[model samples]
Target: MARQLDLVDFIVGLPMPVAASPQANPLDLLPRRPKAWERMVAHVPAEDVRISISTTWTRVVVEQLREDGCGDQLRANGSIVSHDVPPGLIWPEPCRLILMTATSAARIHKRWCLEEAPGTGLTNTFRFARQQHADRAAVSQQLRLLGEGQS
Candidate 1:
Protein backbone atom coordinates (compact mmCIF):
# COMPACT_ATOMS: atom_id res chain seq x y z
CA MET A 1 0.00 0.00 0.00
CA ALA A 2 1.17 3.55 -0.75
CA ARG A 3 1.62 5.62 2.38
CA GLN A 4 0.07 9.07 2.38
CA LEU A 5 2.70 11.83 2.78
CA ASP A 6 2.14 14.25 5.65
CA LEU A 7 3.17 17.90 5.92
CA VAL A 8 6.39 16.86 7.67
CA ASP A 9 7.37 14.66 4.73
CA PHE A 10 7.82 17.67 2.46
CA ILE A 11 11.06 19.57 2.05
CA VAL A 12 9.96 22.96 0.75
CA GLY A 13 11.52 24.28 -2.44
CA LEU A 14 13.95 21.43 -2.85
CA PRO A 15 15.94 21.78 -6.06
CA MET A 16 14.74 20.05 -9.19
CA PRO A 17 16.99 17.64 -11.02
CA VAL A 18 19.24 19.34 -13.57
CA ALA A 19 18.09 17.21 -16.42
CA ALA A 20 14.78 15.89 -17.71
CA SER A 21 15.77 12.24 -17.27
CA PRO A 22 17.96 10.04 -15.06
CA GLN A 23 20.17 9.09 -18.00
CA ALA A 24 21.48 12.65 -18.26
CA ASN A 25 25.11 13.27 -17.26
CA PRO A 26 25.27 13.89 -13.53
CA LEU A 27 27.93 16.58 -14.06
CA ASP A 28 25.02 18.77 -15.15
CA LEU A 29 24.20 19.12 -11.49
CA LEU A 30 27.50 20.73 -10.61
CA PRO A 31 26.99 24.38 -9.69
CA ARG A 32 28.36 26.93 -12.09
CA ARG A 33 30.57 29.92 -11.36
CA PRO A 34 29.15 33.39 -11.62
CA LYS A 35 30.08 35.91 -14.30
CA ALA A 36 32.16 37.82 -11.72
CA TRP A 37 34.41 34.82 -11.13
CA GLU A 38 37.53 36.55 -12.43
CA ARG A 39 36.86 39.67 -10.40
CA MET A 40 36.31 37.52 -7.32
CA VAL A 41 39.55 35.62 -7.95
CA ALA A 42 41.44 38.89 -8.26
CA HIS A 43 40.61 39.69 -4.64
CA VAL A 44 41.78 36.31 -3.31
CA PRO A 45 45.53 36.00 -3.05
CA ALA A 46 47.13 33.43 -5.31
CA GLU A 47 49.35 32.35 -2.42
CA ASP A 48 46.40 31.62 -0.11
CA VAL A 49 46.28 28.09 1.32
CA ARG A 50 43.28 26.00 0.36
CA ILE A 51 41.71 22.89 1.85
CA SER A 52 38.65 20.71 1.37
CA ILE A 53 36.61 19.32 4.24
CA SER A 54 33.14 17.94 4.99
CA THR A 55 31.31 18.88 1.79
CA THR A 56 28.24 16.70 1.66
CA TRP A 57 24.55 17.52 2.09
CA THR A 58 22.29 15.37 4.18
CA ARG A 59 18.65 14.78 5.18
CA VAL A 60 17.16 13.36 8.35
CA VAL A 61 14.06 11.86 9.88
CA VAL A 62 12.88 12.82 13.35
CA GLU A 63 9.93 11.33 15.14
CA GLN A 64 8.33 11.95 18.48
CA LEU A 65 8.41 8.51 20.08
CA ARG A 66 6.22 8.41 23.16
CA GLU A 67 7.13 5.89 25.83
CA ASP A 68 4.62 4.20 28.16
CA GLY A 69 5.26 6.54 31.09
CA CYS A 70 7.86 9.04 29.95
CA GLY A 71 6.98 12.19 28.00
CA ASP A 72 7.46 12.32 24.27
CA GLN A 73 11.06 12.14 23.16
CA LEU A 74 12.44 12.73 19.69
CA ARG A 75 14.33 10.01 17.88
CA ALA A 76 16.33 11.31 14.94
CA ASN A 77 18.37 9.72 12.21
CA GLY A 78 19.80 11.00 8.91
CA SER A 79 21.69 10.10 5.76
CA ILE A 80 24.04 12.07 3.54
CA VAL A 81 22.58 12.37 0.02
CA SER A 82 24.52 15.10 -1.81
CA HIS A 83 26.84 12.63 -3.42
CA ASP A 84 26.09 10.08 -6.13
CA VAL A 85 23.86 8.00 -3.85
CA PRO A 86 20.94 6.20 -5.45
CA PRO A 87 17.63 7.63 -4.34
CA GLY A 88 14.07 6.32 -3.69
CA LEU A 89 15.25 3.70 -1.19
CA ILE A 90 12.97 3.24 1.78
CA TRP A 91 13.86 5.27 4.84
CA PRO A 92 12.86 3.73 8.19
CA GLU A 93 10.78 6.77 9.03
CA PRO A 94 7.66 7.74 7.16
CA CYS A 95 8.26 11.50 6.97
CA ARG A 96 11.94 11.67 6.09
CA LEU A 97 12.85 15.16 4.89
CA ILE A 98 15.85 17.34 4.45
CA LEU A 99 16.27 19.59 7.46
CA MET A 100 19.56 21.21 6.53
CA THR A 101 22.34 21.11 4.02
CA ALA A 102 26.04 20.78 4.83
CA THR A 103 28.86 22.44 2.95
CA SER A 104 28.94 21.43 -0.73
CA ALA A 105 32.07 20.75 -2.83
CA ALA A 106 31.02 23.36 -5.39
CA ARG A 107 30.57 25.99 -2.69
CA ILE A 108 33.92 25.15 -1.13
CA HIS A 109 35.73 25.17 -4.47
CA LYS A 110 34.07 28.45 -5.40
CA ARG A 111 35.21 30.10 -2.17
CA TRP A 112 38.77 28.77 -2.15
CA CYS A 113 41.14 28.05 -5.00
CA LEU A 114 41.81 24.32 -4.71
CA GLU A 115 45.02 23.09 -6.19
CA GLU A 116 47.20 19.99 -6.14
CA ALA A 117 49.36 19.49 -3.01
CA PRO A 118 51.21 22.77 -2.56
CA GLY A 119 54.83 22.63 -3.70
CA THR A 120 54.22 20.51 -6.77
CA GLY A 121 51.16 22.51 -7.80
CA LEU A 122 50.99 26.00 -9.21
CA THR A 123 51.12 27.43 -5.68
CA ASN A 124 53.66 27.08 -2.84
CA THR A 125 51.42 28.42 -0.06
CA PHE A 126 51.60 25.26 2.03
CA ARG A 127 55.36 25.00 1.61
CA PHE A 128 55.60 28.62 2.75
CA ALA A 129 53.41 27.93 5.77
CA ARG A 130 55.42 24.85 6.70
CA GLN A 131 58.70 26.71 6.34
CA GLN A 132 57.37 29.63 8.36
CA HIS A 133 56.33 27.27 11.13
CA ALA A 134 59.71 25.54 11.06
CA ASP A 135 61.83 28.74 11.30
CA ARG A 136 62.34 32.18 9.80
CA ALA A 137 65.73 31.05 8.60
CA ALA A 138 64.17 28.13 6.75
CA VAL A 139 61.80 30.52 4.97
CA SER A 140 64.71 32.79 4.00
CA GLN A 141 66.67 29.79 2.73
CA GLN A 142 63.68 28.71 0.63
CA LEU A 143 63.21 32.20 -0.75
CA ARG A 144 66.93 32.39 -1.61
CA LEU A 145 66.78 29.00 -3.35
CA LEU A 146 63.69 30.07 -5.28
CA GLY A 147 65.33 33.38 -6.21
CA GLU A 148 68.09 31.33 -7.81
CA GLY A 149 65.40 29.49 -9.93
CA GLN A 150 65.96 26.20 -8.05
CA SER A 151 62.94 25.45 -5.82
Candidate 2:
Protein backbone atom coordinates (compact mmCIF):
# COMPACT_ATOMS: atom_id res chain seq x y z
CA MET A 1 0.00 0.00 0.00
CA ALA A 2 1.09 3.61 -0.67
CA ARG A 3 0.40 6.76 1.30
CA GLN A 4 -0.03 10.42 0.27
CA LEU A 5 2.53 11.45 2.86
CA ASP A 6 5.33 9.96 0.74
CA LEU A 7 4.63 12.38 -2.10
CA VAL A 8 7.27 14.87 -0.93
CA ASP A 9 10.09 12.36 -0.98
CA PHE A 10 8.90 10.91 -4.29
CA ILE A 11 8.80 14.36 -5.86
CA VAL A 12 12.25 15.09 -4.49
CA GLY A 13 13.54 11.88 -6.04
CA LEU A 14 12.24 12.72 -9.50
CA PRO A 15 14.21 11.87 -12.67
CA MET A 16 15.48 8.43 -11.72
CA PRO A 17 18.08 7.23 -14.24
CA VAL A 18 17.77 3.99 -16.18
CA ALA A 19 20.83 1.75 -16.43
CA ALA A 20 20.52 0.83 -20.12
CA SER A 21 21.06 4.34 -21.52
CA PRO A 22 24.37 5.56 -20.20
CA GLN A 23 25.02 9.28 -20.15
CA ALA A 24 25.68 10.48 -23.68
CA ASN A 25 28.53 12.84 -24.46
CA PRO A 26 27.37 16.43 -24.36
CA LEU A 27 29.22 16.90 -27.65
CA ASP A 28 27.29 13.98 -29.20
CA LEU A 29 24.52 16.42 -30.02
CA LEU A 30 26.22 19.67 -30.90
CA PRO A 31 23.07 21.62 -31.64
CA ARG A 32 23.45 23.52 -34.88
CA ARG A 33 22.36 27.11 -34.99
CA PRO A 34 20.58 28.31 -38.10
CA LYS A 35 22.87 29.97 -40.64
CA ALA A 36 21.53 33.49 -40.61
CA TRP A 37 23.20 34.56 -43.85
CA GLU A 38 21.93 31.56 -45.84
CA ARG A 39 18.48 31.99 -44.37
CA MET A 40 18.44 35.65 -45.35
CA VAL A 41 19.65 34.81 -48.86
CA ALA A 42 16.97 32.17 -49.39
CA HIS A 43 14.30 34.35 -47.86
CA VAL A 44 15.19 37.44 -49.87
CA PRO A 45 16.47 35.57 -52.95
CA ALA A 46 18.09 38.38 -54.92
CA GLU A 47 21.46 39.15 -56.48
CA ASP A 48 22.09 41.80 -53.83
CA VAL A 49 20.08 42.15 -50.63
CA ARG A 50 20.73 43.74 -47.26
CA ILE A 51 19.89 41.81 -44.07
CA SER A 52 20.26 42.70 -40.40
CA ILE A 53 20.76 39.89 -37.87
CA SER A 54 20.29 40.46 -34.12
CA THR A 55 21.51 37.96 -31.55
CA THR A 56 22.31 38.00 -27.81
CA TRP A 57 25.67 36.32 -27.50
CA THR A 58 28.69 36.46 -29.85
CA ARG A 59 28.95 32.84 -30.92
CA VAL A 60 32.03 31.38 -32.60
CA VAL A 61 30.01 30.99 -35.78
CA VAL A 62 29.27 34.69 -35.80
CA GLU A 63 32.95 35.44 -35.22
CA GLN A 64 33.85 33.16 -38.12
CA LEU A 65 31.42 35.05 -40.34
CA ARG A 66 33.13 38.33 -39.45
CA GLU A 67 36.55 36.80 -40.07
CA ASP A 68 35.44 35.35 -43.41
CA GLY A 69 34.94 38.86 -44.83
CA CYS A 70 31.16 38.53 -44.74
CA GLY A 71 31.18 41.78 -42.80
CA ASP A 72 32.88 43.51 -45.72
CA GLN A 73 30.43 42.00 -48.18
CA LEU A 74 27.46 42.98 -46.06
CA ARG A 75 28.85 46.47 -45.69
CA ALA A 76 29.32 46.77 -49.46
CA ASN A 77 25.79 45.42 -49.86
CA GLY A 78 24.57 47.89 -47.19
CA SER A 79 23.40 45.27 -44.62
CA ILE A 80 24.03 45.42 -40.90
CA VAL A 81 23.46 42.55 -38.44
CA SER A 82 23.62 42.60 -34.66
CA HIS A 83 22.75 40.15 -31.89
CA ASP A 84 19.87 42.00 -30.28
CA VAL A 85 16.75 39.94 -30.91
CA PRO A 86 14.86 38.43 -27.97
CA PRO A 87 15.35 34.77 -27.11
CA GLY A 88 13.62 32.07 -29.19
CA LEU A 89 12.75 34.46 -31.98
CA ILE A 90 14.01 35.07 -35.46
CA TRP A 91 14.99 38.52 -36.63
CA PRO A 92 12.31 41.05 -35.63
CA GLU A 93 11.73 42.28 -39.18
CA PRO A 94 8.00 41.97 -39.96
CA CYS A 95 8.46 41.35 -43.69
CA ARG A 96 10.71 38.31 -43.11
CA LEU A 97 8.57 36.49 -40.52
CA ILE A 98 7.09 33.85 -42.84
CA LEU A 99 10.41 33.06 -44.48
CA MET A 100 12.08 32.95 -41.08
CA THR A 101 9.47 30.46 -39.88
CA ALA A 102 10.18 28.13 -42.79
CA THR A 103 13.91 28.47 -42.24
CA SER A 104 13.46 27.71 -38.52
CA ALA A 105 11.48 24.56 -39.30
CA ALA A 106 14.19 23.39 -41.68
CA ARG A 107 16.84 24.12 -39.06
CA ILE A 108 15.02 21.96 -36.53
CA HIS A 109 14.73 19.06 -38.97
CA LYS A 110 18.45 19.33 -39.77
CA ARG A 111 19.36 19.33 -36.08
CA TRP A 112 17.22 16.24 -35.48
CA CYS A 113 19.01 14.48 -38.32
CA LEU A 114 22.40 15.43 -36.89
CA GLU A 115 21.46 14.16 -33.41
CA GLU A 116 20.38 10.83 -34.86
CA ALA A 117 23.28 10.60 -37.28
CA PRO A 118 24.53 7.10 -38.22
CA GLY A 119 27.21 5.51 -35.96
CA THR A 120 26.57 8.02 -33.16
CA GLY A 121 25.60 6.87 -29.66
CA LEU A 122 22.51 9.08 -29.97
CA THR A 123 21.32 7.29 -33.09
CA ASN A 124 18.60 5.14 -31.55
CA THR A 125 15.71 7.48 -30.75
CA PHE A 126 13.32 4.53 -30.50
CA ARG A 127 15.39 2.84 -27.81
CA PHE A 128 15.80 6.11 -25.91
CA ALA A 129 12.05 6.75 -26.05
CA ARG A 130 11.33 3.27 -24.72
CA GLN A 131 13.87 3.70 -21.92
CA GLN A 132 12.26 7.02 -21.01
CA HIS A 133 8.84 5.38 -20.85
CA ALA A 134 10.17 2.59 -18.65
CA ASP A 135 11.86 5.09 -16.35
CA ARG A 136 8.60 7.03 -16.01
CA ALA A 137 6.71 3.83 -15.23
CA ALA A 138 9.16 2.86 -12.50
CA VAL A 139 8.86 6.29 -10.96
CA SER A 140 5.06 6.12 -11.11
CA GLN A 141 5.04 2.72 -9.42
CA GLN A 142 7.32 3.94 -6.66
CA LEU A 143 5.10 6.97 -6.15
CA ARG A 144 1.72 5.25 -6.45
CA LEU A 145 -0.94 7.36 -4.71
CA LEU A 146 -3.38 5.75 -2.29
CA GLY A 147 -7.13 6.33 -2.68
CA GLU A 148 -6.50 8.12 -5.97
CA GLY A 149 -7.03 6.92 -9.52
CA GLN A 150 -4.19 7.05 -12.03
CA SER A 151 -4.48 7.60 -15.72
Name the best candidate (by TM-score). Answer: 1
Off by over 4 Å in 2: 1-20, 31-60, 63-151
> TM-scores for all candidates?
0.19, 0.15
Residue pairs with clashing backbones, model 2? 53-81, 54-82, 54-83, 54-84, 55-83, 55-84
lDDT of 2 at 126: 12
Q: Give the total clashing residue pairs for model 2.
A: 6
Best by lDDT: 1
Writing each residue's lDDT as its tens digit, candidate 1 over 1-151 gives 9987766666555666677433322222233333342233233332332321211312222211112222221223322112222233222211212111123322322333223333322232221122212334443443344334421
The whole-model C-alpha lDDT of candidate 2 against the native structure comes to: 0.27
lDDT of each: 0.28, 0.27
Worst 10 residues of 1 by lDDT: 93-102
Off by over 4 Å in 1: 1-38, 42-134
